[model samples]
Target: EKKDKKDKKEKKRSREENGAAPKCADEKPAKETRVEGAQAAGDVAARKAFLKEHRMTMEGNGVETFFPCYTFAEAKFPAQANEAIQNYAKPTPIQAVSWPVIRAGRDIIGVAETGSGKTMGFALPSLPHILGAKQKLPKVVVLAPTRELAMQTSVEYERLKVNQVCLYGGAPKGDQIKALRTNPDVVIATPGRLIDLCDSGLCDLSQVSYAVLDEADRMLDTGFEEPVRKILGMVNKKRQMLMFTATWPDSVERLASSFLRDPIKLTVGSTELTANVRVKQTVEMIQQYDKDKRLLALLKEYKVGDNSRVIIFVLYKKDAPKVEGLLKGRGYTVGALHGDSSQAMREATIAQFRKGEIPIMVATDVAARGLDIDDIEHVINYSMPLTIEDYIHRIGRTARAGKTGTAHSFFMHPADKNLGWHTAKVLRDAGQPVPPELEKYGPPAVKQVEKTCNISEMAPAPKITFDDSDSD
Candidate 1:
């Protein structure tokens, strides 16, 4: 009896040293006491400090138990998935904190900045989740907002050696249908095309147990909310839902409440809408007619032809081709990307841009979200977008992956003033100088209500400027 007792104690010690929980009935009380003590003191303080240092905010139940991984080994991902990420020494803040929560089969709403490694954060966990399923017939579904994002997502997942297919509207449906028949383990798709396939009996989502809505805010902004809702309704009711977005809005909150069950919300940075601070933003107030000339001047200053890649964002499809022609006529090689471009042309242009064959591309908001090209030195807003949200996404094309870049905008008042009001505040928040002309369009002051008023009879709007230091 003495020898048996000693052996049991040794086994318990070995398990504890390996970071496993004690299985012996007699050892449970001691282990519980130690964990409770740590949780009440050192553990809580250390977790709080770590989250503060990384600018992370976590909410909801089960978040206090969340532990972050610094190195790839600490994450303890499956051997197959680990092999694909061997080149990455450490996970990003989003990726680091998400592994444990997601692997535990908890639904999550992740809000992080763009280029923050959100794709890998969710993808790594899905690999093991899908592998554990009994039969793989589209066990995982990732719905991206754009075709480029969907294709890029598929590329990332394929690296894990998982059989996957990408579905989008701009491409040929025949090929997608053929691939769908093969019973892929994962389906990376856009909402429109995926809905079309489901309606026609080409795709079956009934067996899908995992669904990811990548860039959920953008998806809703682009009029895909109804289709996304329909797609989610088609999936299995007992599914795990992962919703990730760069910004969190009321619309997303409503959607989350409807679908996710007790999801843990993880935010890596501030939830307020703000541009990437790494991009130096400059608003050049000019007449609408002077924009064409000013664009050329700015390009020359940036040395675009000397191996500098720049993206010029326009507000309309009609302007994309015209801007492309203007650049080509000026002895510069350029490509145009807009809603009207065929899928083949869009892919070809992106391929050329990636290979350095075309150093400049004039594009619309369609290109703003998901072009994976690196080293984009500058982003020029030839025509300011209608909303400040769009402006943030356009400028986000630059200043990626720890590299500093610049965004220059040709701001025309009266036409762009509505958006300029919020834009100025965004600039001030980033420590960038807000042009005085654009600053004058701030919100109006409250005045006595008039029974009847003419357009010219109203009082001039109050001039406002945001000073972060003065804001308490």
Candidate 2:
């Protein structure tokens, strides 16, 4: 009887294999879960677990991460990450969009206003790529427009445990060359000095697979087109490319077309420039002579003790020293930073500001961009910036790290009458009501006046300036 049962079971299995259900058996086959891999046992599982937990915190979709990626902390990155990197939050709007694209080894052209965390927008992803690649270590090159930008990038890049160096002018060339000797994984440089290093055969950029042109619009404005082109030609053609800028102009577009291949256009300006919502915008109108007094009054109201922070911006380098001197004399503990100051002084002043020893900084437009000082509670624009772009950068110092901030601008007598239309347009874009009080001093060239020039269907008409082309 047992022999007969065995024969019957074998016949049933054959039938199931032949596209039919077993005649007697009613259960399905059981499978075992394999939690190991070819390289590292359980690596895939651990990675999935880590990413599942971290992805949400890092990508809070603006609701969670309100400020820039001042710190890589919110990402809950691996504990092996350097400690200095843990104090700041996750990525900004532009950084979040660009990080994945860069990690995928794709080209990207990011349009974010200055002080919008554009530096780390590409740096974070590229750092890991260069550090983690199992293949030959590839170099990542970042080209910034000015010395200050190079230093800013250096500060963030150094926060990572990876090997990196900054090579730019204004600092001693010997020290820069010494840093380069380490065979760094990343290089932050200016277009001019980078070209010089390439010519000297001191920097081997042929193996550089990731190339970034930070502040692309500024590069074009400063006439670094030829130098930038030469640097781009040296890096690997099969590598990734990224360009970030505050404003997207024809020059930036042309450079993007030349450098990046089918680049992804990641922009926060869904409708217009006003979408740079990380900054707080305000206008304080007063008489020209009362500008100084009103600024003092605003400072008094803002109240920066040893804990709070302030960054005051002046239009000209001449005004930087003047304002700083006066503020210091008034027991405000202020310092002046401008292009005229030596690199050492600039760095020292920045250090003092960072240490909170100097609570207030009076700077010019040259100090406007590429600065990453954080937790600034107040941005007092003593005078309105000549360029709306400068205004954006100045105010961006505040409202960081999920913190509310104040940006006070003086639209004193001269500015209300003299400031350009674009400045007012920026205000309108911010959703802030630009009261007629801002235009208290006077109107532009032409004004409307009622006249009895029987025209259309009325007996009176207001004369308006109209070119033939302006007519619809």
Candidate 3:
């Protein structure tokens, strides 16, 4: 017993010493600097200090409990990957962890929350393996919960300019099928359209050997389980599997155990804590009638300038276009994205945000999944998201690519008090500050939600500045 106890202690120490979490960068199409610490929703100065210290440590030591720099060559990636890495400083945390596993052709269940670099973590490693020399038969297949997540990952794959195809609902998939004829090594797609393609015999995922579930938790929460299971049936069971989420809920774990084999279970900060830390969180108790007024006041007070980009997330998709109209009427150059939006427009809005043409963005949960633009300084929770997972992905839009960002949520009705308090608790547990207003509100009883269809509308777009390198 004594020997066993000693061994256990040593093992625990080793795990703590080595079990650093994964991190990732923003899909900043622009030449923006990487974001470091999270936005300080409460203690801006302290968070800034933490970021500065963390940056110094990372720069000096070249490793972090959450993020560590890694080379593409070390990841066994193709030569072109080195150029992409050279363009950026270092691989974010997610890239460091997920890169090795995906590259090794192993199944993974990645449980870090957003802004932990989860997107790039999987993206960088997977692309090279799939886009390999000669007769790679759509070896990689990506499944996302929302159109936004699917499109964003597709955009990043395009930025990498790897031969890939993106398929999702909202637009005619003829173009996607045409791209597939290019014999793309990677396919980034939503569960819905992928299923349709599988059923119609337009694409063959039977040759697929690697798969990823981005924002896995949200996929389950947003009712994508059935579609995911059907899609899974289409792929090769022997393929490497990677499942990532902001947090590891029970459902997420069950799915991992079923899909991943002898898999490495990676848990970063708890889901609630991951996004809350970097967010400059704040809340002003107000009357229900005063909600909009209070939001405008907070925006005016914080005042994200023309230079910075912002995303405002709300519970209902109906509110996304409403708020977009409201802010646009107020003379803020704003646009909207949601489930109801066509795939084409969703891509257009994201492109607009990336090119710095539209600095302000308002949306429902569509923006929450994996919209990966960088330098998003503010994430305004116009109202509480439907669940904690939604909140995690929502605010994670900011403080990405190793840059600092702020996230603010407003609390109005007493019934809605738990939303703010829970968000605060998640922050406090992560060693982040919980403002006094959190305690002032106290715990809350749950309020019922209105039954609305999941699909929401997205805004149309002007032309964007980004381009791609097609293989000739």
Top-scoring candidate (lDDT): 1
> Candidate 2, residues 44-110: lDDT per residue as tens digits?
3333333233221121111111222223443334454556445645566666545544554557667
RMSD of 3: 15.9
**Among all windows of ten consecutive residues in candidate 3, which has the lowest summed lDDT?**
56-65
Model 1's lDDT to the true fold? 0.81
In terms of TM-score, how similar is model 1 to the real structure?
Answer: 0.84
Tell how far residue 26 is off in model 3, in angstroms: 57
**Tens digit of lDDT per residue, candidate 1, span 40-91?**
3435556556677667777766566666666687677777886678787678
RMSD of 2: 13.5
Relative to the unseen true structure, what is the C-alpha lDDT of residue 250 in candidate 2, on a scale of 0 to 100?
Answer: 47
Distance from true location, Cα of 289 in model 3, Å: 2.3
TM-score of each: 0.84, 0.72, 0.74
Best by TM-score: 1
